[model samples]
Target: MRNNRAAPPWAHRWALPAMVLVTVFFVAPFLLNVRFAFSSWTSFRAEITWNGLENFGTLIDQDLLANAVTVTVLYAVLCMAIQNTVSLSLALALQRTSRINTIFRSAFFLPTLISPLAAGYIWRGLLAPDGAVNSFLGIEWAWLGEPSTALLVVAFIDAWKWSGLITLVYIAGLNSIPRSLLESATVDGAGPWTRFRRVVFPMLAPALTFNVAVTLVGALSAYDVIAATTGGGPGDHTRALNVVMRQQWGQGFFGSASALGFTVTLLVIATAVPLVWWLRRREVAG
Candidate 1:
């Protein structure tokens, strides 16, 4: 008997509150941000008059937009590369389900649980001119003070913070591969490196896609660690787009700030869409 009865009203009642919350919080704020991006709202004035693309023009003229975009892209790329490399290595090292491996995994993952700001602050002290790092290395180098290395240092910190989570994802993907395939490859006289390169690595495409997309996007929008570490210091060398938006907002350039936010959103969508599409194709091919 195929009883095609509609779902009861209470069965779906909870969704209403969730939808309302999304509308009130995410959707509404996003729409308002778009509205303000094209306006002339500032601390100097109350009336928000539409000025077309003037806010964007102002930002472009100031070179703030270009600088922020460049810094953000470089930071994101560095973080993505570092994080994936570290995470993949960790995943491989901890692939076996042994007591030692378990303990080490837990130890490594503890950092992921810590607040980013706290991590940044801790690293800031450690990387200070006369801090633990310098003490250990016996070289009193200013890690966060140098324009050349400050951005890289901050990017490394961000990558370190999130590598554990990405490692677990890779571990999960590795574990999902059937043992039969590995055993078959072993019997066929395939070496460890060859088997991994030809079999294991290709099989991890889905995980790779997820980890790469997430790390890249998250780095693009990074703020907390950088804020606590450098505050976009060394003469705005490490200033991400979000930090630039915050500076504008602090100075009461609401419209310009909103324009920056909108630009970030567009950039994320632009980068992520194509990246994901290409990654998905690789997954299929793999």
Candidate 2:
């Protein structure tokens, strides 16, 4: 014979605070943003009147939306590529456990703990025309003032800031692989590169999926680093979608800013959904 009893009320109440916080903070703001995106809310106006699609139309006419989209995609792509490359290299190099590797991992991860804005400001100072970087190289160049190089430089810095975390993820993935698999490959006379390409790489599909998706989304939503470093300057060469939204907000175009934010949300969803699906498929295939 068995007896059944429902859980205590307190047992289910544990999640209530988290649910309330999520509704109040994330869900509420998102709904409000959607509503504002369809209205005419601005600092110059006392009333927020419905103006369906007007804000988006105006942005489209001005070509600001296209430019922001292009810049944002470019920046995201560059960051994803650079961060993953650096991270994978570091993970491979430090996969072996040792005191030196531990020290190096800690040192690399220290940058991840710093505020993005603060890191940008630090990089700003270092990349100035007469800054330490130029002095050390014995040459002067305005790193942040050049249109062609500013975006890439900012992307590299963003990658530098996050590579540590991604490296740790890769290291975790590497350690999870069966040691016998690597040893078998070695006995089969497979070289390091061949082993990685044929065995280790395929086994790391899940980690690659997580790292790539995260890095792409983070880069798409990047603002603080670009703001502190270039402020979307050098003629808007590095102006991400968020930077453009901030500019719109500053210019008393609240509805337009909200529309831009909504667009960013849409872009992220659209991009990430397909990418994650494709990555998951690749994981299965691997």
Candidate 3:
């Protein structure tokens, strides 16, 4: 008689534990969150009756919804734009081999290694009216205090912290380009701009997709920087969805907060779905 193929021993031992943890921590909590989204909640009790789409209606009908969606979308777009532009520029500048390049790259990445809260606080001081930024420029604008400048400052802080990460991603993509392709292009009288536009960029699509996706999600979920810098202050001018959710939770609106969270997740998926599909098609075509 032939022996039956044995299951992997590691699967029998580790897989069950992994599944248990995932179910307990991730799947269970997510289900509970969905349940909360469909209920009415107070500080100590869930209404327990099915509210169906009422929670969603409240979330949508609020004026904060308009502000949240607009600001979040704008933040995502601006973050992607600034991060990609600065990162690609840095990647190009650092493609050369030199001690200076190594030092600059390390320095640039230092901010990313710091906690977002810490980085935000650091910049908060720097952007104060009497601080380094204004002192250096001789402009006495209060960065985080003014409604006009608060959101801009928050966006700038995020870009400063994360552009290094995108730069590294772009650098890896840049290195993956076939040297032979670059040399061949040079031989064919292709200028640096042509080589980048035609050969390098198309190849960097995968990296671009990743960088943009991360930037979008990160910017949309932005709270740490704003919390640390302005605490979503100046009359909520810099308040993000995450901050709003926190405020609701504090006000004993757990169900409402959960509903807002679910909505944000949906927004993320809505933004990512088309980009992911388009990138996959591009990969197939390439």
Candidate 4:
């Protein structure tokens, strides 16, 4: 005797609800931006008028957009580098579970829970001319008010805030390695460096890919932290693409801002697609 009930249909999976939510909240708004990118608006007081490609044309007439590209790319790259290095090192150090390790893990990850605005303000205070950092170092210069150091300091601050997240990601990857594999390597008389290089690093490829992708995207879109700390100063030295978009908005260039944002979205997509594809290939090869 056999059961007669048919299996459930898989045409409409449970992901449909999430897809619908994204369509409503994200995709719709993105399409709206595309539509508005070709139109002009000064403020809420004025009607949006179609201006063809004039908004994009204005982007080419000025050096602001070019400078923004350089600043944004540099800042984002620094953030990705600092965060990944700190997080991976922390993960390797914290791999062994112990009472002390648990306490330290909690302490390190505490920054992630702090609001970006609050973290930015706190660092701003610490980096002030007369603040704790300068007081401790016996310097009179303003770290966040100088063109030479402001952008790097801002990137470092962003890295500090998010490193804990990638630490956790790396920890999960580290913990997933089988003890048997490590034991086999030990039996082969492999030293720690050799064992890690040959076995552990290869296995952690997925975590690396994930950390890189998320951090790159986050750094490119950084806003609130920069807003609270440097506000795109000193003299636009720390302005990322998003901060530049905000400046355009503040100056009542809504249509041009939309075009700028659209350009940024295309840039991120262009960057992420290739990088992610390469990482996925590396995962397979590893």
Question: Of the candidates shown, which would achieve the greatest lDDT relative to the real structure?
Answer: 2
Off by over 4 Å in 3: 1-12, 44-47, 60-62
Clash pairs, candidate 3, are none
What are the RMSDs of all candidates, in order?
Answer: 1.9, 2.4, 2.9, 3.1
- Tell how far residue 195 is off in model 3, in angstroms: 0.7
Give lDDT tens digits, candidate 4, residues 1-286.
7754764576358668989999999999899888778888767747888889888778668667777778888888999999999999999999889999888899999989888888899999999999999888898888899999998889989999988888999999999988899899999999999899988998888898899988987788888789999999998898877888888899888888888788778778977999899999988998
Q: Looking at candidate 3, what is the lDDT of residue 185? A: 92
Model 2 clash pairs?
Answer: none
Estimate, for each residue in 171-230, the C-alpha lDDT of model 3 and write its tens digit.
998898889999999999999899988888888888888988889877888888988998
Candidate 3: 10-residue stretch with minimal lDDT = 2-11
TM-scores for every predicted model: 0.94, 0.93, 0.91, 0.90
- Return whichever of 1 and 4 wins on TM-score: 1
Better of 2 and 3 by lDDT: 2
Ranking by TM-score: 1, 2, 3, 4
Among all windows of ten consecutive residues in candidate 4, which has the lowest summed lDDT? 3-12
Tens-place lDDT per residue, model 2, 1-286, is 6544877778669989999999999999999999999999989995998999999999999888988888998999999999999999999999988999999999999989988898899999999999999999999999989998899989988998899999999999999999999999999999999999999999999999999999999899989899899999888899889999999999999999999999889889988999999999988998
